[model samples]
Target chain A: MGKIFDFQFMIEIIPSILKGIPFTIMIAVVGFAVGIVIGLFGALFKIYKVPVLNKLTGLYVSFVRGTPLVVQILLIYYAFPILIKLINFKFGTKIDISWIPAVVFMFIAYSLNAGAYLTESIRASILAVDKGQMEAAESVGMTMWQAMIRIVLPQAAKISLPVFANFFIGLLKDTSLAFTAAVPEIMGQAKIQAGRASRFFEAYIDAALIYWGLCIILERIVAFIEKRNKESA
Target chain B: MSNVMIEMNNIHKKFGNNHVLKGVDLTVNEGETVALLGSSGSGKSTLLRCINLLETPDAGDVRINDYSFTASKINKHVKLEARRRTAMVFQNFGLFANKTALENVTEALITVRKKSKSEAIEIGRKYLDKVGLLEQANQYPSTLSGGQKQRVAISRALALDPKIILFDEPTSALDPELVGEVQRVIRKVAEEKVTMLIVTHEMDFARDVADKVAFMSEGQIIETATPSEFFTNPKNERTQKFLERYLQRFSYSI
Candidate 1:
């Protein structure tokens, strides 16, 4: 009771927690990268009002946005085995569940979630671009798709730069949720260390510091990019 | 028979309940510069937009050179064909904000015309030089003056070598002092025998540069004639009132 905090214990466990860094970064980087692609098509479908895809994208976006991240992770994680079983039982196929990795589940869940939010961000950004840009491109003989790729998207990407940075940071920290699926990300490693040593406060502090460090480094890199972008523009 | 560079027949456009262009018929021959004059809400801009299919008309036929299509039946192929033959300079410059002046001029050349980078850049530079914007080639639209931006836009249009160039209130958004620079470039383009249709509020500029001045009222072209006859001996009563209203500001006498 006399010693309020354990600095030495926090230092001792930093290395173990650091081991989870790659998993956290991999999940977040891959999730966000794929999410951008999903979001782009989702936004385009909605913008162009593509018949069936637009409605499906809207339902997907709403489903993801309406639910919590932890719930989504668990739902998708549990749903997969059941889905695979249904497929195997219904069809004459040997679709083994062991082949799929747990990390893949987190990737799918996080990406779908990120994609929903990014769809709105990307859509608003695309809409925010001046109407004249498209007109000018079309006036010069570019088809709609050509104008979109050459003219509209670059400006929209620039407008959504800060949003991308913010969302990526959110995603990086959100990777801690991977613990629910027993994937042993940063928070999972922290929990293991705490249970082993019975020093919950120290282990948690170590995890928090690691997250803060990663966020600071990434924020600096994004700041540098934003500055360079401003100078060029 | 004058070789028609552009022929728009019975163009009708409606914005919700407001009918903007009502059965408008217009023709532009090769090497002709026609300036469209009208007060606000008179649909001059909408008429110009229909040529390139920017704003689709509710009903009409737009023929740009050999590429013509019925407005209601416009498909991707026909739209591109008509659009490729015509270019527009907007009131807002419409320069790609993300692109440098040179890239803006060369982008369509590389993408639409399938020109090589070196060739596109060369063509881009020549047009930029024509508009006197060659020195600002690397500068973005955000950094350039509005006049310079419009000059870049004009050069971008010129680089395409379209059958006709449509300018929608090009100088309307420029500063009072800057308007002269854009006007000068346009005057020079007119001298080069480029077929152009310019929508403008400047009666003096229209008179000075136009081969013919056409006055629009409500949603229709009420009068069209040579600048000399149109300005000096107007036939329509509405044209008399319209000119008097504009000329009154500067106490300009016809």
Candidate 2:
């Protein structure tokens, strides 16, 4: 049997796929915002070599990086409640986390995964700052934290900007993985439409087109920021 | 009255197997400028860094004005206290590249000195003017010339109003043409009677700007005397040999 290509079917499913764009955007924005926060502390712990926190961060980054993100999402979505219930039973305390959405759990998993990657980028950026910068600040009686915040990190942030922008685009694409947890993001909506109409090719193509459009839009925003930063310098 | 601005006693430092400093004793009196004359790897920079606890000594004591810390153990409190009284001008002109010339001068004031924004800016401008970089105050280090950046670094150190200022070969990184401008700014600072410890290779500048000159060799201060006496009548054989070598290479007569 010859395979059939239907441009009309793809066009028809475009609006349905576009409807999931908001959720995709939400996951990307929230995951990245929270990921960067975690990444910064993870970076600082490693940079400063804080006693126990350093080792913990190292283990955490390794685990997240070594495991597939989909596995992490599945674990958080399916097993997280059982783990929490186990804690509640062990401590003889009634605790509930059922109110939270599966999408929330998916975001948490994605945040942690992104954070592990960002940790390396931020740590390298922080390292890329001149050693004499810290020494100069310290010579003027600024503490390490003060020196880092006031002198080093600003420069480091500039160095990490492009890397952060790339991660944001990557995160936007990765939100498609939220479909595995039935979060109704772009891929999830497309899968449902495809299942209903038995038009997998057209529905999936529609989803890919939407994601591609979003990424291109994001690239322009990143380019705008980089251009602005360069002009200011 | 205690006129001593910095007193480093038996300072010792080691980096791995390299014993960079060994029982190096140094003192800088208030309103005095002392130049540390030494060959490279003679522990001159290490000695200067120890005074500010930037390179914590393996052993000994450092006193900056009234604050003192024994280097036998961790004493962040005393180190910070001493650090507040001293600022170092790095050989590399370590002005924060991200900050403008004025911000470089104002950063420590607002954060460490707890000065108001207007007051800090006012003080920053005064020092920038002193270094003759007021016109370039808004410029970042990357855009400034080596001499201008060093001048900004000097202004930053000076603006802190520390009891003592340490200059770690401040003009060493500049081009020969740029060197004079930075040296002139340093000479102006010397005239201000701020206790200064300068580690320098420029014998002429040292003799002109330093009231006292101390020579170091093999991690020890081999000779210390008034600039006139040290240059005219060298005491140690090592000091005489060093001066001869330095003079012959630089083609300068004492």
Candidate 3:
């Protein structure tokens, strides 16, 4: 809709951007999966106040959340290999790092970002579950871990579903930063197409529309799942 | 002598500066129904929770059936084994909100007891039926009435076949009309001679179901007596006063 934006050029590059959609989606999904594992451990440590690790988790979450996502992407992309090398050098280990994909680095960075935000969500949701639920499970002879996994986490998950959905949507948009790493996600495709045509605004608009459409589709699927879950629950 | 099912000796618990259970002791024999009565803040619930090590008493000796350990010396396996020997029915029902009534009843049976799913379901059904909730087994806790939820919880407890069942003010959270239904289920359980230790404000239910009623005040058991003798002829002045204050409105009902 902006002046000097060529509608024709936007339509032409939309196909190119569409090709990058899979990369965008793949990273988001992989990031989300990795993020859940990190978030659960971080949240549990924070909840239990597990000595020194809890303090470290607090600092990790604060640092990740306080900084910009793009900075994290660039910092991890450039600096992680150096840190890995230092660890290998000191430990006398020959962990091969060269074979890792560029997108794997994106996965690591984005997951850490998503994990920090999700740690808070998971902690709040777990706390929000009724105390009695844990007691009831333990009362019936469950170990604490069994009670948490069986009784408490399910209820907590239901409470945190909306937050999870919002985070996933946010993660999709955050995938735009992956373009900085030369990962051919939606925004990466747009950047390449716009650079070729020298028409940045139109390509970005096309990419934006695709993201909007994907989000809408994701939201619909979530709504439908929620409805089915409600019926069963 | 009858088998001793649960024994708490010199149990001591503190919440920072607040001392809730102060060197308290009680014994529940097999097939005994001991009703614990106390005014609020008397530490009756805390004492019940100590039986399962739910509160992790600062100091005490707990012996639940074959597992015995000083509270401070307990390891995870002994603690869990002792817990496995007893089940608690909480005042708020405490039904797993995510599980159906049947699942709640079968959870420990399948997971802790290592029973087959079909076997657990069959056992779960029997207990659900015992509580007159066989039809509601598929329903979630949120959908059931408070009475139904508590009944499902009772079935859950019964399904474990625990050495003892601990009730922490089981009917206190129910609506007045709903109280009778759960009380009926508990009464039925008591009639079967299942070992039980219940904390309750219901003086009449205590008198009706408990073989002995123990009075607790300020983190100590003041006097324990047979239901008839305790209700009609309380020997302790503190207990007499507590009963007088708590029973004023229900004086004629008592």
Report the lDDT tens digits of candidate 1 across residue range A1-233.
Answer: 35678788889889999999988998999899999999999999999999999999999999999999999999989999999999999996899988998999999999899999999999999999998888888888898998999899999999999999999999999999999998888999999998987889999988999999999999999999999999998
- TM-scores across all candidates? 0.97, 0.96, 0.94
Model 2 per-residue lDDT tens digits across residues B135-213: 9988888899999999999999989999998999888888999999999989998898888999999999999999999
Off by over 4 Å in 1: A1-6, B252-254
Instruction: Give the Å error, residue A78, model 1.
Output: 0.6
Pairs clashing in candidate 1?
none
Indicate which candidate wins on TM-score: 1
Scored against the true structure, residue B209 in model 3 reaches a CA lDDT of: 92
Among the numbered candidates, top lDDT falls to 1
Kindly list the per-residue Cα lDDT of model 1 for residues B55-163, writing each as its tens digit: 8899989888887789779887877898889889999999999899999999999999999999999999999999998999999999999999999999999999999
Quantify how close model 3 is to the true structure by its C-alpha RMSD in Å.
Answer: 2.6
Candidate 3 docks with a DockQ of 0.82
Model 3 residue A66 distance off true place after TM-score fit, in angstroms = 1.2
Question: In model 1 chain A, which range of ten residues has the least summed lDDT?
Answer: A1-10
> Candidate 2 docking category?
high
User: In candidate 3, which residue ranges exceed 4 Å CA deviation?
Assistant: A1-5, A80-100, B251-254
